[model samples]
Target: MRRDVTAIVRRRGAGHDGGRPAPRRHRAHGPAIAHSGVAHLLLAVALARGLAWPAVASQAEAASLAFPAAADARVEEERPEANFGADPGLRTDGGGDPEVRSYLRFDVGGVAGRVSRATLRLYVAAGGETADGPQVYRAGNDWREADVTWNDQPAPSGAIVDDAGAIAEEGWLELDVTRVVDGNGVYTFALFPQSGDGANFHAREADYPPQLVVATGDDRGGGPLVSTPTPPPGSGGDGAAIRASVETTPVRHGDDAADDAAVWIHPTDPGRSAIVGTDKLGGLAIYDLAGEELAYYADSTPNNVDLRYNFPVGGERIALVVTSDTDTDSLRAYQVDPATRELDDVTVRPIDVGIGVAGLCMYVSPVSGRYFAFVGDSSGTVQQWELFDDGTGKVDAAKVRTLSVGSTTEGCVADDGTGDLYVAEEDVGIWRYGAEPEAGGERTEVDAVGGGHLTADVEGLAIYYGGDGGGYLLASSQGSDEFVVYERRGGNAYVTTFSVTAGAVDGVSHTDGLDVTNAALGVAFPNGLFVAQDDRNGDDNQNFKLVPWDDIARAASPPLAVDTGWDPRRVGG
Candidate 1:
C-alpha cells in the first residue's frame, strides 16, 4: 500500500510561511517548544553541513533549496514483492523478520552550481532494535516508492554514501549528504543494515517528515566558503629546523619589545632592501639588509607595520608603510624613500581608532582597486578602514567594518592576492576573516589552544606570498618560543613548526611579531628572509632575528618549500 506525503518546499530567500507547529517525532506525541527566529534553525543546519550562509551583501543570494520527501518506506527482503511504502515508520536491518531496508526519495531541484553542502534531516521513531545504525547508499533514481519491491526495487550503488553510526533515536538526526548531491534531480537513498540489529526512522507521512536541504554558492559569489588553519596556543612542540640566521643587537627601549615588522625590497637594487620594525616602548626602527638599524623614528609608540607598493599619491608611485600608533591611537602612514631606504611621515591624516591601537595590517582588494587597513585592539576588536585621498594631496581613510575573536589580539596580516585577513588572538589562536567590508564576522580558527601546534599567547601573523595566491602563513608561537607555519591559501592548514635555536647569537623565543618576504636580499639570505621579534636574545634586551626562508621551508616532517618569488615592491603592476 502507498500513502501520500505532505510536501514542504523551502528555499533560501523565499518568504517563509507561518505554518503552525507540528508534533515532533522525539517529543511526547505533541507540538514541541518553538525557537526564537526561524533563520536560526536554518543557519545552524546549514553550518553543520559546511554550506555558505548567503553573503550578507546579497542576503538573498545564497544558492539554497529544500525539498520535502516525495516517497519513503521500508521494503522487506523476505517478501520480495511486498510493498511497505505506506508504513508510518521506516525500519532497517535484519534479525528475526529478516532484512528491512528503507528507501527515501526527494524531488530536489531549482538550484544549480557547485553544491557545497547537503543534509538529510530525518526523524528517528525510537524503540528500533539497538543497532549501530545503517549504512546509506545512493539508490537508483528510477524506482517509485509506491511500486518499490525487494525483488524489483531499484538497485543501489556499492559505494557507501554516508553512515549514521547508532543515532540516539531521540531527536532529529542530520546526515551529511553533500557528496551524494552532484546535481539537481531525483535524489534517492537506501538505508541497509550494517549489522544484524535494526533502527526505525519516522516516514514522510508521520508527524515529523523527512527533508533534503541543499546549499550552494554561485561561482560569482565572494569568498564565504574558503577554509584556513591555525595552531592553538599553550601547546608543546617537537623537533625544530635549523636554518640560516642573523640577529640584530637588542633595541634600546625599556622592554624594547620588537612588536612587528615588514620587508621593504628595493625595486632596482635587491641588495639595498631594508626591514622596518616596530618598537612598542619606543617608535619605529628601519634596518639595512645587514640587520643594522639605519634610522629610528621616535614620534610615536608603533606596534606593527605593513607595506604596499606603487600607492598612487599625487600621481607619484610611492611605497607606503602603514603602522598602528599606540601613543595616539591612530593609523600613521609613511612614504617609503626607496632611494635612501628611509621612512618619512606623509601624515596622510591619522585614522583614529579611539585608543589602544595594537596590531595592524593592510589589504589590497583584487576585485576593487582599493586599499584597506585592519587594526586590532587589546580588547580583541578588529576594525577595518578603506584608505583613499579626499580630493586632496593628503591621504585619508574611513572606518568601514569591525569584528572580534575574544581575548588580547596582536600582529595582523592581509593577503592582497586572496583578500583574506589573518589576526592573532594572543591567548587563543590565529583567525582568518574576510577582509571585504561586507564580509561579516564569519571567522575560521586556523588553530586552537588544545591543538599543541601553538603555545598560548600566539602573537604575530605574516604570510609568505607565493605566486598565484599560494604560500604560507607564519605565526609567532610566543608561549613555546617557536614559530608555526600554515598554507597561506584555503583554510590556513598547518605545515610545520621551527625555532631560532642557539647558534650564532642565541635562540629566538617569546616572539612578539614577525615578517617574511620571498625576495632575495643578499648572498647570506639567498632564499629571502624571516624577521621575528625575539623577546629573549643572548642576555641583551628584546630584539629581532633574521632567518633564511630556505632553512624553514626545507626543515622536513613539518617543512614547507614554496616559490620564493612574490615581490611586493612590484605590487599594483
Candidate 2:
C-alpha cells in the first residue's frame, strides 16, 4: 500500500466551512491488509461490470505505479560517448588524424545560487588503441572551480586544457567537479582531444552535439562591487609654464623635412624666439616664433643640433650648432641674429673636441652667458667645446675636455638653472656631470631609475621644474612602451618614481627626440605642451607630439583607483 505525502480534505455539505473525511478502501494481501483508495475505486467500478475485486485491484496498481516522478528527477551526468576528435587540416602529414575536444553545459534556472561542486568524467578504451583521450571544459556564467582533477589527479588550473593521454579500453579518466553556482537556463557542453604525435585529429560534427538543462533554486543577492580610487587633490600642483613650437626652415641643398630642432627665446624681445632645425642633407633651417622661415645656412650637415641662448660676442643673441654625423662627424656652430632671426654673416667652424660627434648639445651659460657644446660619439666618449668669437660670424672651437661614458651615447640635456648636465647612455643609464661644463669634470652616476620598468634601449631625456623647487626627470623607455619619470633629490639621487601613458609622446610607438621648455616658453606653447618626436611614424623623419604638462604633473603625483568587481564572463566568453 502507498500513501500520498499531502493530506486531502473533502467538503462535507452545502455552506459547510469544514470538510468530511473521504471514503477509505482496504484490501487483503498475503497476511497483510493494504489501504488502497485508488485501487478500491477501480475495483468498485469493475464489480459493476461483473469483474473480480482482487484482479481489478492488481491491474490498477500495476498500471498506475510503473513510472515515478522521482526516478526522472534531473541529476548531473557525464556523457563519455560525446567525446571530441581532432582536426586534420592542422596536421602536416598527409594522413588525416583526429584531435581532442571537450565541453560542459548545464542550466541553473533563472535563479542565482553559489555552485557547491561540479565534475566531468571521461571514459577511455584500454590498450591505447584510440588516437587520444578526451579533454573536458566548462562553459557558463558565474561558475568557477579551483582545483579540477582528471583521473582523480589535479589538473593544470590556469591555462585551457588542450591535450590528453591515449584512450585505453580499461582506462577511463574522471574529472572531479570542484564548485559551481549557476543561474537558471539551458547550457551547452563539449569534449575535445589533442593528437598525441604529429598526426592530425578531426572532430566528428555529430558527436555529443549540444544539450541544455534547467536549474531549480531560489535567487541569492548579488556579489560586492569594486572600483578604482580617485587621485588626491592638489596632486598636480602649479608647474612651470614652459612652451615651445617647431617650424621647417628652407636651406640650400637641404630637404624641407626637418629632423631635429632647438629654440632660443630673445632676451630682449621674449615674444620673438629663434628656432633652428636640421634639413638632413642641407644646412640649418632658421625660423621665427611665428613659424616664418627667416634664414638658411649651407655650411654644416644639420643631423641634430641645439641653440645656446647668448654666447661670447653674440651679445643677447644666440649661437646655433649642429651635429654633422653624415659629413665630417663633427660638431659645427653658427651665429644667429636674434632680432632678424637670420644666420649671422659669420664664418662657420667645427669643434673637434667631442668623442661622439654624432650626438651633441649646445648649452648656453645662464649666469656667465658663455656657450659650450657637448658631443657624443659611437664609442661613448663625450667631448666638451667652448666657443671663442673670432670677430666673424664663425667662432673658433677649443677642446674643453672628454668624459668616458657607456657605449652608444644617445640623449643629453643641460639644466640652465642648476648647471647640471644629464646624459643618457643606451645601455648604461643616466650620468650626471657637475656644475662646470668642462672635460674630466666631477661626475656622479645617478641611480638607474628603471631597473625592471625600462627595457634595454633607453632613448630620450627631459626635465621639468616642479613647483616644489625640485624637478622631474622624464626618460623614454623605448623597448618597454613606457615613459618613466623620477623626482630629483639633492644631487644625482631621484626621490620618487612614476609613469604617464598619455605623456608618452615619443616611445608610445618609438620615441626618439625629447625636449622641455622653460616657464616663459611653456606659456606660449599651445596648451602648455611638452614635445616628443616619433621616428617610427609613417614618415621616416620624426613627427612631434604635444603633451599637456598638467596631465604629466598629476600622473607623477599618486596612484588612481580601479574597479575590482569587473566580471569577464557576463560580458562575453
Candidate 3:
C-alpha cells in the first residue's frame, strides 16, 4: 500500500484578525518530497492579553484532553527545551521581523510505533510576551516536520494554523503544526502576541518578558494514514546480488541524447553480456556491465542496434545486426565474439524487398532455433529476414517477407514464444502481423479497449508475460513522461492500462527505446531488467537506464524506477 500526503496547511480562513491576506495552500503527491531547513515562526496574538503564565499552561493541558491517549505512546522524562533571539535589522516589509524571531529544537524519545501525525503544544511563561504561531515545513533528507505556531484569534494571514481563536491563557499562544514530507528547510514566523484588545493592544517589544513551552503528540496507533508496501524478497539482497549501476556521458556531450540500448547475453556463458547504445547522433557505442567502453562504431548516421542469431554457417553462433537511417536503407550485420567479447567484422545488406528500412528488431526464435530480424521502415512497412547460417557459423542476411501497415512505422518486435510480430505506428495503436509478415498481407490491429490512451509519441514497446497465461504490453508515452503498461488478453489484444514514471534519470526526458529480458547476463543480474534511453541527459547523444524487473512485477501502480547512478563510459574498465 502506498499512501500520499493529501494536504498541508497552517491556518483556516481568508485573512487574519488584522485583515492580512491568507497564505496559499501547497498540495503535492508522488515520490518527490520538498524539504527546506528554514523554521516558520507563528505568533498567537490573542493569548498575550493580560493573561498570567501559569494559567496558560493549564489551558494547554485542557485542550490536550480532547484527544485519547495514543496506543503507541511512551513518556520521555527529558526537560523541555528553549531558544530566544531577535535581530534589529530584520524588517516587516521583508515578510519577517528579525527582532521577534525565536528558534526551538527538541527531540521526542520513546517512539514506540510509526507516527502518522505530530502536534506541538507551546506555553508562554510570562504575561507581557506572545509566541509566534506554528507553520509546518518539510526536510529533504528525512520526512520530518518543523511545525511553528503563534497565539491569536484566527492566527495571522499567511500563517500555518488549523483555525485561529482566542488564546485560552494570558500572554501565551497555542500553535498547531503539520509536517511536509519533502521540505528540508526551517520555517520562520514573526512572534508578536498583543497584550490588549484588537483596537487598544500594542505589540510588545522583543525585550519584553517571554517564556516558551513545547509538547509533541504521539498518535502513532491512530491518526492520519501512512502506508508503504513491503519490498520484494532478495531485492536489496546482501553481497553477491548484481546491484544495478548507472553512468552518464560527460555533461559536455550533446543535450538529451541517450535514447535506446540493446544487450547481448553471451550464449555460452550467461554471466557475460555486451551492449550497444544509440547516441541519437550517428554514433554507436558498445559497453560491458562494469561501465567500461569496449568499442565505438560510428556510422555518421545510425538509428538502432539489435542482436539476432542468423543461420549458423560453420558450427558457429552469429548474433549482431544494426539498423541505420542511411539513404541506401539496409540492415547491417557483424560477427560477434562470445569469448573475446568483440564485434570482429561488419556487413551491410540491403532489404531484398524494395521497402526501405526504418527500425530493427532482432531476437532468437525459441521455437525455430533460428535467428529472426524484423525491419520497420518509413515506408510504413515491416520486413522479415532469415539470417543465413554460413558454414563458418556466420549469419548472412536474406529477405524473408515484407508486411505493409499505416504510414510511418516506428518500432517492431518478434515474440520469441509465439512467433508473432508486434509493430507500433506513429498515429495508430500497436498492430500484430502473422508469424510470416508478407506483401499485401494486412496485419490485425489489437483491440483498442484499454489501448486508447496510448499517447501520440509511443516510441518504445516491450512485452512481459505473466504466469497466468496473460501478459503485458509496456508502451512509452514519451510526450507524457509516463510509461503505460497494458494487459494483453487472448488474440494478442491489450485490455487494461497502467502507468509508472521512472525516478529522476538524466537524459530520459523523452523515452525513445526500451527492452526487457529475464535471462541472467551475470550471476548478479536481476531476473528481469528494463532498459530505456534518456534523451534529456546529454546533447546529441542519449544515455541508458536499467530498472529492476521485480519492482515492475510487484508494483500495482506505475512501473517507474529510479536511476541509481550515472556513468558515461561504454565498457567496464
Tell me, by TM-score, which candidate is best: 1
lDDT, candidates in the order shown: 0.69, 0.41, 0.42
CA-RMSD of model 3: 16.6
Off by over 4 Å in 2: 1-259, 267-275, 279-283, 286-299, 314-325, 345-348, 354-356, 364-369, 435-442, 447-453, 466-469, 489-508, 521-528, 539-541, 558-573
Q: What tens digits encode model 2's per-residue C-alpha lDDT throughout 1-573?
A: 111101111113453212212221110100111224554345334323433222211221111100000000001113223211221111111113332222333433323233211223222211223444333333322221221212221122211212233433222232322211233343333343343332221111211111121111110111110011223466332121111122232233422334456655554554465556566576666655444567767766656676554455544334454454547666665566556767653435544553436666765555665667777767888777776676654567676677778688767776655677888787767777853554345677664535644555676676665443466666666665456565554654432333323211112245555555434432233212355544443333434444434334323323111111221111101
Q: Deviation in angstroms for 452 in model 2?
A: 5.1
Q: Model 2's lDDT to the true fold?
A: 0.41
Q: Candidate 1 lDDT, tens digit per residue, 1-573? A: 111112221211234223322223332111122333455355445534534343222234545554568888777877888887876777777655477788898876666655545667676653543446676667777877788888877787533445666555445555655544655787888887766667767676664466676665432122232111212343222345342245665677856567788888888877788889888788889887667889898888888888898777776877888889888899988888878889888766667878488888898887787888888888888899887755665678888898866878877888888888888888777788888899899988899765758888888888888887788898888888788888888877777778877532456778888889887775445667888888766567778787767656644343355466777866665
- Between the candidate structures 1 and 3, which one is better when assessed by TM-score? 1
Candidate order by lDDT, decreasing, is: 1, 3, 2
Among all candidates shown, the one with the greatest lDDT: 1
Cα error, residue 565 of model 2, in Å, equals 46
lDDT of 3 by residue, 90-133 (tens): 11110222112222222233222222223333322122121222
**Residue 53, candidate 2: how far off, in angstroms?**
87
